[model samples]
Target: MRNILVVNGSVSGDASVSRALVEVAVQRLLGINPDASVTHRDLSHGAVPHLTPATVAGVRAVANTDHELSTQALSDELIAELQAADVVVIGAPMHNFSIPSSLRAWFDHVLRRRVTFSYSEAGPKGLLTSKRRHMRSFDPPW
Candidate 1:
Protein backbone atom coordinates (compact mmCIF):
# COMPACT_ATOMS: atom_id res chain seq x y z
CA MET A 1 0.00 0.00 0.00
CA ARG A 2 1.28 3.47 -0.83
CA ASN A 3 1.65 6.03 1.94
CA ILE A 4 1.06 9.62 0.87
CA LEU A 5 1.83 12.75 2.85
CA VAL A 6 -0.17 15.87 2.06
CA VAL A 7 1.04 19.15 3.47
CA ASN A 8 -1.36 22.09 3.45
CA GLY A 9 0.42 25.42 3.77
CA SER A 10 -2.34 27.87 2.93
CA VAL A 11 -3.54 30.06 5.76
CA SER A 12 -6.84 30.76 3.98
CA GLY A 13 -8.04 27.25 4.88
CA ASP A 14 -10.99 26.05 2.82
CA ALA A 15 -10.97 29.21 0.74
CA SER A 16 -7.47 28.54 -0.55
CA VAL A 17 -7.13 27.62 -4.21
CA SER A 18 -3.94 25.69 -3.47
CA ARG A 19 -5.79 23.54 -0.96
CA ALA A 20 -8.61 22.87 -3.42
CA LEU A 21 -6.09 21.72 -5.97
CA VAL A 22 -4.49 19.51 -3.36
CA GLU A 23 -7.86 17.90 -2.66
CA VAL A 24 -8.29 17.10 -6.33
CA ALA A 25 -4.81 15.62 -6.53
CA VAL A 26 -5.42 13.50 -3.44
CA GLN A 27 -8.73 12.21 -4.76
CA ARG A 28 -7.05 11.26 -8.02
CA LEU A 29 -4.31 9.43 -6.17
CA LEU A 30 -6.88 7.59 -4.06
CA GLY A 31 -8.72 6.59 -7.21
CA ILE A 32 -5.52 5.22 -8.71
CA ASN A 33 -4.48 3.40 -5.54
CA PRO A 34 -7.47 2.33 -3.50
CA ASP A 35 -5.35 0.90 -0.70
CA ALA A 36 -3.23 4.03 -0.32
CA SER A 37 -3.06 5.68 3.07
CA VAL A 38 -2.77 9.43 3.44
CA THR A 39 -1.29 11.53 6.21
CA HIS A 40 -2.25 15.20 6.29
CA ARG A 41 -0.19 17.93 7.91
CA ASP A 42 -2.25 21.08 8.03
CA LEU A 43 0.25 23.86 8.64
CA SER A 44 -2.29 26.67 8.72
CA HIS A 45 -4.28 25.05 11.52
CA GLY A 46 -1.29 23.77 13.48
CA ALA A 47 1.80 25.59 12.39
CA VAL A 48 5.15 24.08 13.22
CA PRO A 49 7.16 26.02 15.74
CA HIS A 50 9.67 28.42 14.29
CA LEU A 51 13.29 27.39 14.41
CA THR A 52 14.62 29.19 17.44
CA PRO A 53 17.89 28.65 19.26
CA ALA A 54 16.24 26.05 21.47
CA THR A 55 14.90 24.16 18.47
CA VAL A 56 18.34 24.24 16.88
CA ALA A 57 19.80 22.83 20.06
CA GLY A 58 17.21 20.06 19.99
CA VAL A 59 18.17 19.16 16.44
CA ARG A 60 21.83 19.09 17.31
CA ALA A 61 21.17 16.93 20.34
CA VAL A 62 19.26 14.40 18.29
CA ALA A 63 21.89 14.30 15.57
CA ASN A 64 24.86 14.04 17.88
CA THR A 65 23.65 12.03 20.85
CA ASP A 66 20.24 10.66 19.94
CA HIS A 67 18.92 12.54 22.97
CA GLU A 68 15.39 13.78 23.38
CA LEU A 69 15.08 17.53 23.69
CA SER A 70 12.06 19.74 24.29
CA THR A 71 11.03 19.80 20.64
CA GLN A 72 12.27 16.29 19.98
CA ALA A 73 8.84 14.71 19.92
CA LEU A 74 7.50 17.11 17.33
CA SER A 75 10.60 16.82 15.17
CA ASP A 76 10.54 13.04 15.40
CA GLU A 77 6.93 12.94 14.34
CA LEU A 78 7.59 15.13 11.31
CA ILE A 79 10.63 13.13 10.31
CA ALA A 80 8.73 9.90 10.73
CA GLU A 81 5.97 11.13 8.44
CA LEU A 82 8.52 12.04 5.77
CA GLN A 83 10.32 8.75 6.14
CA ALA A 84 7.18 6.67 5.91
CA ALA A 85 5.71 8.48 2.94
CA ASP A 86 6.01 6.97 -0.52
CA VAL A 87 4.81 10.25 -2.06
CA VAL A 88 4.61 13.79 -0.67
CA VAL A 89 2.40 16.61 -1.92
CA ILE A 90 2.81 20.19 -0.74
CA GLY A 91 0.23 22.91 -1.30
CA ALA A 92 1.75 26.35 -1.02
CA PRO A 93 0.25 29.59 -2.27
CA MET A 94 2.40 32.49 -3.35
CA HIS A 95 2.21 35.13 -0.65
CA ASN A 96 4.13 38.35 -1.26
CA PHE A 97 5.86 36.68 -4.18
CA SER A 98 7.14 33.90 -1.94
CA ILE A 99 5.99 30.90 0.04
CA PRO A 100 4.11 31.27 3.32
CA SER A 101 5.85 31.35 6.70
CA SER A 102 3.94 28.28 7.88
CA LEU A 103 5.34 26.26 4.98
CA ARG A 104 8.85 27.52 5.76
CA ALA A 105 8.43 26.37 9.35
CA TRP A 106 7.37 22.95 8.16
CA PHE A 107 10.47 22.74 6.00
CA ASP A 108 12.62 23.81 8.93
CA HIS A 109 11.29 20.96 11.01
CA VAL A 110 11.72 18.32 8.32
CA LEU A 111 15.13 19.41 7.03
CA ARG A 112 17.12 18.17 9.97
CA ARG A 113 20.70 17.07 10.12
CA ARG A 114 21.07 13.30 9.85
CA VAL A 115 17.31 13.13 9.50
CA THR A 116 16.35 14.49 6.07
CA PHE A 117 19.91 15.16 4.99
CA SER A 118 23.54 14.58 5.92
CA TYR A 119 26.90 16.07 5.08
CA SER A 120 28.95 13.93 2.76
CA GLU A 121 32.48 14.47 1.49
CA ALA A 122 31.07 16.39 -1.45
CA GLY A 123 28.19 18.26 0.16
CA PRO A 124 24.80 17.88 1.85
CA LYS A 125 22.67 15.08 0.43
CA GLY A 126 18.96 14.52 0.70
CA LEU A 127 17.92 11.43 2.64
CA LEU A 128 14.37 11.21 1.44
CA THR A 129 13.79 9.09 -1.66
CA SER A 130 10.06 9.61 -1.89
CA LYS A 131 8.49 11.37 -4.87
CA ARG A 132 7.48 14.94 -4.08
CA ARG A 133 4.82 17.05 -5.80
CA HIS A 134 4.44 20.76 -5.15
CA MET A 135 1.35 22.78 -6.06
CA ARG A 136 1.35 26.56 -6.04
CA SER A 137 -1.56 28.91 -6.73
CA PHE A 138 -1.39 32.60 -7.43
CA ASP A 139 -4.10 35.25 -7.63
CA PRO A 140 -4.06 37.28 -10.80
CA PRO A 141 -3.72 41.03 -10.58
CA TRP A 142 -7.03 42.75 -11.17
Candidate 2:
Protein backbone atom coordinates (compact mmCIF):
# COMPACT_ATOMS: atom_id res chain seq x y z
CA MET A 1 0.00 0.00 0.00
CA ARG A 2 1.22 3.48 -0.80
CA ASN A 3 -0.73 5.28 1.91
CA ILE A 4 -1.48 3.70 5.29
CA LEU A 5 -3.84 5.14 7.92
CA VAL A 6 -3.31 3.98 11.50
CA VAL A 7 -5.99 4.59 14.10
CA ASN A 8 -5.30 4.12 17.80
CA GLY A 9 -8.40 3.83 19.97
CA SER A 10 -6.80 2.77 23.22
CA VAL A 11 -7.36 4.91 26.29
CA SER A 12 -4.42 3.23 28.06
CA GLY A 13 -1.98 5.22 25.91
CA ASP A 14 1.47 3.63 25.68
CA ALA A 15 0.41 0.70 27.84
CA SER A 16 -2.19 -0.52 25.38
CA VAL A 17 -1.68 -4.01 23.99
CA SER A 18 -3.74 -3.27 20.92
CA ARG A 19 -1.51 -0.34 20.12
CA ALA A 20 1.53 -2.57 20.43
CA LEU A 21 -0.02 -5.04 18.04
CA VAL A 22 -0.73 -2.27 15.60
CA GLU A 23 2.87 -1.08 15.88
CA VAL A 24 4.20 -4.52 15.06
CA ALA A 25 1.78 -4.84 12.17
CA VAL A 26 2.77 -1.45 10.84
CA GLN A 27 6.43 -2.28 11.06
CA ARG A 28 5.90 -5.53 9.17
CA LEU A 29 3.90 -3.69 6.53
CA LEU A 30 6.66 -1.09 6.19
CA GLY A 31 9.20 -3.90 5.73
CA ILE A 32 7.07 -5.20 2.89
CA ASN A 33 6.63 -1.74 1.35
CA PRO A 34 9.51 0.52 2.27
CA ASP A 35 8.12 3.39 0.23
CA ALA A 36 4.66 3.47 1.84
CA SER A 37 3.70 6.56 3.83
CA VAL A 38 1.89 6.29 7.15
CA THR A 39 -0.58 8.62 8.89
CA HIS A 40 -1.73 8.29 12.47
CA ARG A 41 -4.96 9.24 14.25
CA ASP A 42 -4.97 8.95 18.03
CA LEU A 43 -8.53 8.81 19.34
CA SER A 44 -7.63 8.67 23.04
CA HIS A 45 -7.34 12.47 23.21
CA GLY A 46 -10.73 13.49 21.82
CA ALA A 47 -9.57 14.16 18.28
CA VAL A 48 -13.05 13.13 17.15
CA PRO A 49 -15.94 14.47 19.20
CA HIS A 50 -18.98 12.48 20.25
CA LEU A 51 -22.01 12.61 18.01
CA THR A 52 -24.30 15.58 18.56
CA PRO A 53 -27.35 16.95 16.80
CA ALA A 54 -25.20 19.33 14.81
CA THR A 55 -22.69 16.61 13.85
CA VAL A 56 -25.52 14.32 12.88
CA ALA A 57 -26.94 16.99 10.66
CA GLY A 58 -23.51 17.45 9.17
CA VAL A 59 -23.10 13.74 8.40
CA ARG A 60 -26.51 13.79 6.80
CA ALA A 61 -25.48 16.76 4.63
CA VAL A 62 -28.37 18.84 5.95
CA ALA A 63 -26.23 21.18 8.03
CA ASN A 64 -27.72 24.65 8.55
CA THR A 65 -26.27 26.50 11.55
CA ASP A 66 -22.63 27.47 11.97
CA HIS A 67 -21.89 24.56 14.32
CA GLU A 68 -23.49 22.14 11.92
CA LEU A 69 -21.61 23.60 9.00
CA SER A 70 -18.32 23.33 10.86
CA THR A 71 -19.07 19.76 11.84
CA GLN A 72 -19.93 19.03 8.23
CA ALA A 73 -16.56 20.33 7.17
CA LEU A 74 -14.83 18.16 9.75
CA SER A 75 -16.76 15.11 8.56
CA ASP A 76 -15.77 15.89 4.99
CA GLU A 77 -12.14 16.12 6.05
CA LEU A 78 -12.28 12.72 7.79
CA ILE A 79 -13.96 11.16 4.78
CA ALA A 80 -11.24 12.54 2.57
CA GLU A 81 -8.62 11.02 4.83
CA LEU A 82 -10.30 7.64 4.58
CA GLN A 83 -10.65 7.93 0.84
CA ALA A 84 -6.98 8.76 0.39
CA ALA A 85 -5.77 5.76 2.34
CA ASP A 86 -4.75 2.51 0.61
CA VAL A 87 -4.88 0.53 3.84
CA VAL A 88 -6.41 1.24 7.27
CA VAL A 89 -4.99 -0.16 10.49
CA ILE A 90 -7.11 0.13 13.65
CA GLY A 91 -5.96 -0.65 17.19
CA ALA A 92 -9.09 -1.13 19.28
CA PRO A 93 -9.17 -2.76 22.69
CA MET A 94 -12.43 -4.29 23.78
CA HIS A 95 -14.12 -2.21 26.49
CA ASN A 96 -17.48 -3.30 27.96
CA PHE A 97 -17.85 -5.65 24.98
CA SER A 98 -17.72 -2.73 22.52
CA ILE A 99 -15.28 -0.30 20.96
CA PRO A 100 -14.12 2.90 22.65
CA SER A 101 -16.38 5.95 22.47
CA SER A 102 -13.83 7.99 20.56
CA LEU A 103 -13.52 5.34 17.88
CA ARG A 104 -17.29 5.12 17.66
CA ALA A 105 -17.39 8.86 17.24
CA TRP A 106 -14.82 8.60 14.47
CA PHE A 107 -17.09 6.12 12.73
CA ASP A 108 -20.02 8.48 13.22
CA HIS A 109 -18.16 11.23 11.44
CA VAL A 110 -16.88 9.29 8.40
CA LEU A 111 -19.69 6.85 7.67
CA ARG A 112 -22.00 9.01 5.58
CA ARG A 113 -25.14 7.57 4.02
CA ARG A 114 -24.63 8.34 0.35
CA VAL A 115 -20.97 9.20 0.65
CA THR A 116 -19.38 6.07 2.10
CA PHE A 117 -22.14 3.53 1.63
CA SER A 118 -25.48 3.04 -0.05
CA TYR A 119 -28.41 0.65 0.18
CA SER A 120 -29.24 -1.29 -2.90
CA GLU A 121 -32.01 -3.77 -3.80
CA ALA A 122 -29.73 -6.60 -2.71
CA GLY A 123 -27.99 -5.16 0.34
CA PRO A 124 -25.75 -2.34 1.57
CA LYS A 125 -22.58 -1.76 -0.47
CA GLY A 126 -19.56 0.14 0.71
CA LEU A 127 -18.22 2.74 -1.71
CA LEU A 128 -14.62 2.21 -0.65
CA THR A 129 -13.85 -0.99 -2.50
CA SER A 130 -10.09 -1.33 -2.91
CA LYS A 131 -8.89 -0.27 0.52
CA ARG A 132 -7.73 -3.00 2.91
CA ARG A 133 -8.60 -2.89 6.61
CA HIS A 134 -6.51 -4.44 9.38
CA MET A 135 -7.89 -4.27 12.93
CA ARG A 136 -6.47 -5.54 16.22
CA SER A 137 -8.79 -5.96 19.20
CA PHE A 138 -7.04 -7.02 22.42
CA ASP A 139 -9.57 -7.97 25.06
CA PRO A 140 -7.76 -7.74 28.37
CA PRO A 141 -9.20 -9.18 31.57
CA TRP A 142 -11.03 -6.35 33.34
Instruction: After superposing candidate 2 on the true structure, give the runs of residues whose Cα lies further than 4 Å from its correct spot.
Output: 133-142
> Which residue pairs in model 1 clash with each other?
none
Q: What is the C-alpha local distance difference test score of each model? A: 0.77, 0.85
Model 2 C-alpha lDDT per residue in residues 9-120, reported as the tens digit of each score: 8999768888888887788789999999999988998978987765679877789988888888988988988999998888878988999888999998889988899999
Q: lDDT score of model 2?
A: 0.85
Error of 1 at 38 (Å): 1.0
TM-score of each: 0.82, 0.90
Among the numbered candidates, top lDDT falls to 2
- The alpha-carbon lDDT assigned to residue 103 of candidate 2 equals 91
Measured by TM-score, the strongest candidate is 2
Per-residue alpha-carbon lDDT of candidate 1 for residues 44-132, written as tens digits (9 for 90 to 100): 86658777754666644454323336567677788889899887888878989989888888887778887689999999989785555
lDDT of 2 at 131: 74
